[model samples]
Target: MAETVGDYVLQRLREWGVQQVFAYPGDGINGIVTAFGRAGDDPHFIQARHEEMSAFQAVGYAKFSGRVGVCMATSGPGAIHLLNGLYDAKLDHVPVVAIVGQTERSAMGGAYQQEVDLQALFKDVAGDYLVEVNVPEQLPNAIDRAFRTAMSRRAPTAVIIPSDVQEEAYTPPAHAFKQVPSSPPGLTRPAAVPSAPDLRRAAEVINAGSRVAILVGQGARAAAAEVQQVAEATGAGVAKALLGKDVLSDDLPYVTGVIGLLGTRPSYELMRDCDTLLIVGSNFPYSQFLPEFGKARAVQIDLDGSMIGMRYPTEVNLVGDAAATLRALLPLLTGTPAKAWREKIEAGVAGWWRTMEQQSMVNADPVNPMRVVWELSERIPHDAIVTADSGSAANWYARLLRVRGEIRGSLSGTLASMGPAVPYAIGAKFAHPDRPAVAITGDGAMQMNGMAELLTIARYAHRWADPRCVVCVLHNNDLNQVTWELRAMGGAPKFEESQQLPDVSYADIARAMGLDAITVRSPDELGPAWDRALGAGRPTVIDVYCDPEVPPIPPHVTLEQASSRLRAVLKGDPGGLHLVVQGAKTKLREVLPGQDR
Candidate 1:
């Protein structure tokens, strides 16, 4: 039997070492679906409930596996649904390759059903590389380039194939005029390091300072050991960008936790007090949270030259792989250890953890959201892969959850989009079937997409060696994050019509899907509930009723923000009194006796 272009597509993906392709089926992709059947699932087809979830699952797989993620969809609506997740990958700088089926070539310009101009649609999201394989001969080069560009640029790339082309007999590029040939699929990335002169200059900036602070991001994950060595050599406090939360363990005494709006007081103080700054593999966008310009001499090292020195005014910018560059610069650092500065930072970090504990114990309507994550922190498996959705839940995950040991954690850092927590966990399961994966999500996100993805978990749970996939839903019955954003950022009262969420029993729904389920309405139930879920032989959904009025306060609040909340209360905000009480109690933890603040 002659190989069809669709069969060749899967063959090429296999050659590129893709073990699974996250996808959904449709009539437009019938040819490829048929090829999957003929190929006997050599590269497994992981069907997602929707095209968007498929893309997110790929992102999750790529992020955790440190490989290129591939996702597929049919034309038009299926293609359009993939945009958000692809954007999430692009913004978060994850490598993903998207394959989509297009309408038949004859129907493309005729406006046939499901025929949309895919080239223009994908141009921006997959701007690094976008190609339409109009002929069987174009398949090899097109698919190869998509994977290569995705990896080289760390961005989403796309390859579009018309239905007719996918069904045509496959043909390799001829050794003739007008033919373009591609080499076999393989990528060998070089370890790039800055020049010796540049490394010395950066080291000089570090060695001259009496107090140093290092900021690490997702880019620094590979350079964890180098980052620690540099921190020790310079007596620096290390602050992690939210995306790099797992880059270094929170157990390190000099680690100041996450740095940004959703950060700790110690991290804030680390930036405020540092005389010099070393930014590694992080392009953390919030400059306001950093030291005041000119107060600290800064040096930045990143793999991408374009992103270097954009977030701060740096004295030196070294474009290289973080680990390689940091290793080269470490020996040149000759500063005397700032013992006093190190002790101050460590003390602040200690005090901040105490504050977090105190804050978690504060009273609320049913349960404080912080306590939910705090409980998880106490019991999270050392090797767990944790993911958090964007919402008020992210606030708790950022502050309360302490990532330690081999625990890997991530979320939509740049996109900050909702509804990827469960799908990410699903991807994590596929990435490492032997490890336990946990997801922390808000009620709003669960209702958006997490509920449907639970069935995906139930479907694949048996394949995992360790089937402890836990989805912890913060059931607050409100769009809590945006509701608080309206009050704190816009001085607007919470309009119940838009902020309120329909109450649903997520645990009951999970139970219906044949997974273990638990419900917690009291703080006392959190620890035990987590234990049961983490020990479960299959996937589990934990629905905890959290307080909607508990504000996600930042490490430092401006006077204007305080006034805005006051105005919101004066303007008859819903839950105004409860908001004030919870906010006060939560914030009081920072200023209490023994706290650094």
Candidate 2:
């Protein structure tokens, strides 16, 4: 049989090393779907319950494997549903390729059913590349460029294939599709390294400062050892952006936890007190968490030149690959370590961890969410891959989960959207079949997507020999994060209509999907529940009933936030009063004899 446009597209995708393509079947995409079926399992096709989940699973695959993820959807609504997850990939700087099926060329733009302007719909989210197969011959080049651009730019790209174009015969003599391919595909260019002059300038800035702090993000994933080397040589305290949490271990003496509201007190102190801030691979947008511009000199190193001065003004900007840049910059620096600075940072880290341990141990009626996260942190295997959804669940995850050695995970960083954890866990499990994959999500986020995703997990549970996928649902029966945000942001009253969530049995939902499920109503059952899920040898869900009143208190709260808490308490919110009391309790610690007081 002669090759079709759909066959060429799938062939190119296989050449690009796309092992798994998240896809949903539809009439408009039947040709491509059939082509995928003919290709066998080299590039396995994963069927998602929703188009959104398909795209999100792609994002998760990219994040865990450090490779470009691919997703396919049908025309109109299916394509539109991909926008959110694609935007998550874009904002998080992960590579993803989206192949969307479009209406037949003849039916487009004539008030026909399911006819959407693909280019216009994807303009903002898929900024790196977006093109339609208007001409049958254009499919080959479009597919090539879309994957290439996505990998190079670390952003999402889109290719729209019209139904007619997909079915066109590929008898190519005048087109490049049948021509001799140059160098076979899938070869990628190496990332640029820092120049000598940039290294010298960066070294000079670091050498002049007595107190240096190193902040890293996902860009530094490959440079963890080099980052430690630079920190040791320069006597710098290391602070991780949320995306870089796993780059360094929490127990490391010089390593401070993440920065921002989901960050640690010691990390805030390091940022505030450092004389020179060296930012590598992170475009953390919370400038307020950084030291004032004039107060501290800054040096930024990133693969993207445009992102160099984006987060903070830099005295030195080194545009290059993170590991290479760090390696080059190390030799130019003075080897003198600042002993006093290191001691101070170590002391601060110790104090902060003590406080964290205390907070994580607090027993509250209805199980405390922090205790659940803390217990899981202690029990997870060394090679586990963990994920967390947005909302109050993130608070416990950010604060309690410690990433060390081979243990790694991710959260929705810039996009901060909910409903990705369940799918992300499935993706992560697929990416590393032998590693334990866990998803931590809230009641609201679980209900939003977890129910459908439970089926996705059950479908693929038998594919991998090791069945260690777990979903920990924090069942608080409220939009707990937003409820706290309303009070913390000074909103007058908590609107019950928008803030409360219906009580539902996530365990039952998981069980109905043929997953091993357990529900824990008390803290005593937490450890055993986690152990059971970890050893279930199948996809499992642990529905934990958590306290709804625990506030995700920020390390630093503004006066306006304080006012908001007061107002919320005055307006008769019991949860607000709990927050206020917690604040007072924290303050009272300063007056205790064995503490800082």
Best by lDDT: 1
Q: What are the per-residue Cα lDDT tens digits for candidate 1 across 1-597?
A: 899999999999999999999999998788898999999986899999999999999999999999999999999999999999999999999999999999999887997999899999998999999999998888699999999989989999999999998899999999989888999998888999988888889888899999999999999999999999999999999999999999999999999999988999899999999999999999999999999999999999899998888988999999999998888888898889899999999999998898888888888889999999999999999999999999998888888899899999999999999999999999999999999999999999999999999989999888889999999999999999999999999999999999999998998999999999999999999999999999977899999999998889999999999999999999999899999988988888877844432
Model 2 over residues 90-110: C-alpha lDDT tens digits?
999999999999999999889
Q: Return the TM-score for candidate 2, rounded to 2 decimals.
A: 0.96
List clashing residue pairs in candidate 2.
Answer: none
Steric clash pairs (candidate 1): none
TM-score of each: 0.99, 0.96
Clashes of each: 0, 0
In model 1, how large is the Cα lDDT of residue 219? 96
Candidate 1 at 171: error in angstroms? 0.8
lDDT of 1 at 532: 95
